[model samples]
Target: MAGPRHVRPGPMVEAWLIEAMERYNEESLERREAYAAQVHLPGAVLQDLVWWALQALPDEILVGLDVDGSQAHQPDVEAAFAGEAHRDGLFAGQGFVISEAAVVNRGDSYSVHHLPEDWTDDLFRSDRGNRGGRFTHWLHTHPNAPAVPSGADADAAQETLGVDMILGLRFSPEGPLPWFDDVDGTRRTLAAPEQPRRFGRRGPPVLGVAPSGHRIHEIQLIAFHRTGLGVNVVLVDDEGWPYGWSQD
Candidate 1:
């Protein structure tokens, strides 16, 4: 692989993705459920997925490869993320970045594949053939839920050659969904989650407001191989390098 150019998003790309993410995220909140979409910043020879991962925050997002599972679309964070392969800290060994997201129309889902009505038949069977052959990776969102996989989600991973990712968002006006903190497993978050205050063992929760005006609680992103191993994710720059590469 060639060395990274270490490019960052230009002004136009920055403004566009930020505005788009805000609109899309707010639209999802208006319906009070899950939303799916992709983000990409065009580099000279490739499309960068980190811009998508960063912009779609306080909401669930999955960053994986393009439809063909192409390496050209991967993010440059791994090298910068791992400390030149010496110490990766908590985030290490991540498999892929997104090629681009597959966005559908505005919608809601308790889990993403309880997907929306707009995710109609054409998503599966294209005019040419099954669209499944075009993708090697997959990702989905878990609104008001943890990034952990459900039994159904595990079954869905059987087809992936790269890895599967889950993006979970927890925010307020929670409606009926309760924050599930009882589960045991490793989790990676974009922002450190604020713990709910308890008056006693069963106290009602107190939440905080996010920049988006939602009472945000947590943002989680996790990736796993089809065989059931964790993959670390690091948000990076356009050239497939982490943002901090030059700081050191």
Candidate 2:
């Protein structure tokens, strides 16, 4: 929706992603090792690019923000790092795109010299349930970087052919591959560093205590979404965390 806001993750969602990140890292390491062994390269020479999608708006059917009818044409990372890979002789490379679109309707059409792969379809054909209606984005891979959106990728976003996109790259197998986005389209890319992890503390449990000769206890869980700022807040006993909520 608007520009990026530094929001902390909620207890539930934070725990989810933290767990997901652990599994993700383990899987990535496994993939790297497998690829290295197959290619007879050092395990350190393969890298995985982690991608995250952003939604412009949160889904609010009750509020009547029915974000329906969207499409994602085929996106290609072929031209993304081809030249770099050829010259660099890197073992493996990765990239991904993030957007608010509902579906990756087709394959990559954005070629260096031709139109993007999925530009021909007119109706995006949303999925049947709420999953299809929620804030959605895409993730894609690339072997290297100029790392800006290509003329084609930029055009796809500017023309509203696609919602929004993020492209990522890893230089070497042993090096870190960062995610980047042209947030304001000012030639500056917003680099989303790895989100820091927080250790968890067991939440307080509900217990009955005498209050004026009556037993009372309450466990409050609150989740709030603010469209104006594209954020979601969760409160537990007055502490707050913000999520990168979207508006598109």
Candidate 3:
């Protein structure tokens, strides 16, 4: 892929992605929850840092998208993987597609989350799937929250090389926490509902109903460089076609 384009996830990967977001809410907000919703992707390594995302039982799952051209884009730009070229010669330049990923990090909500020095020293060592646990860019989920970056999320981005992404999943049966929409920024959703909406916003949000019986109200995905410049993320199929690429 050479020209600017979209990131497409293969069918297998898409099957569980939205569900992964839903799984975030399934965690009990009352305590630290460790649900085994893991994603494992096989990739390469760097001089000391590992590029692969691994499985960990952390409070938050830091999903490192196996971004293309991550190295070149590192000090500044991401590197293009050899087989990532698109059929039409158009490539996903601005952001990443969730074709494959790995998991990282976990902790209680009480204290601040940080990549501990021992974390990098021990986990980053040469291993089977990953070497050092370093990544160019990172993404995480916000259960029952909007996709907008929180103050903590922005603080985490400062440690990243390329960009940081947030996958926000909103659902019903909200429990003690209520849905908050007052915070403002550009919002991107999967598909607007077909029903006529009475909302003040431009469109009603796309509602993905997962088999888990959760009423998924909205799925938000966004990326931004550490500098705070917003990055565009295009959900695409394995064939490099935009997901739901049609006007219905």
Instruction: Give the C-alpha miss distance for residue 19 in model 1, angstroms.
Output: 19
Best first by lDDT, ranked: 1, 3, 2
lDDT of candidate model 1 versus the reference: 0.42
- The global Cα lDDT (0 to 1) of model 2 is 0.22
For model 2, state the Cα shift of residue 139 in Å: 5.1
Listed per model in order, the count of residue pairs whose N, CA or C atoms clash below 3 Å is 7, 29, 19
Q: Quick one: best lDDT, which candidate? A: 1
How far is 104's C-alpha from truth in model 3 (Å)?
A: 1.1
Which candidate, 1 or 2, would have the higher lDDT against the true structure? 1
- By the TM-score metric, which is better: model 2 or model 3? 3
The clash tally of candidate 3 reads 19
Which of candidates 1 and 3 reaches a greater TM-score?
Answer: 3
**Cα RMSD (angstroms) for every candidate in the order listed:** 11.9, 21.2, 13.6
Q: Who wins the TM-score comparison?
A: 3
- How far residue 125's Cα lies from its native spot in candidate 2, in Å, is 11
Model 2 misplaced regions, further than 4 Å: 1-109, 112-140, 158-162, 174-248
lDDT of 1 by residue, 128-163 (tens): 221243344556666667778877677756655556
- Let me know the TM-score candidate 3 reaches against the reference structure: 0.54
Q: Model 1 Cα RMSD, Å?
A: 11.9
Error of 1 at 6 (Å): 21
Better structure of 2 and 3 per lDDT: 3
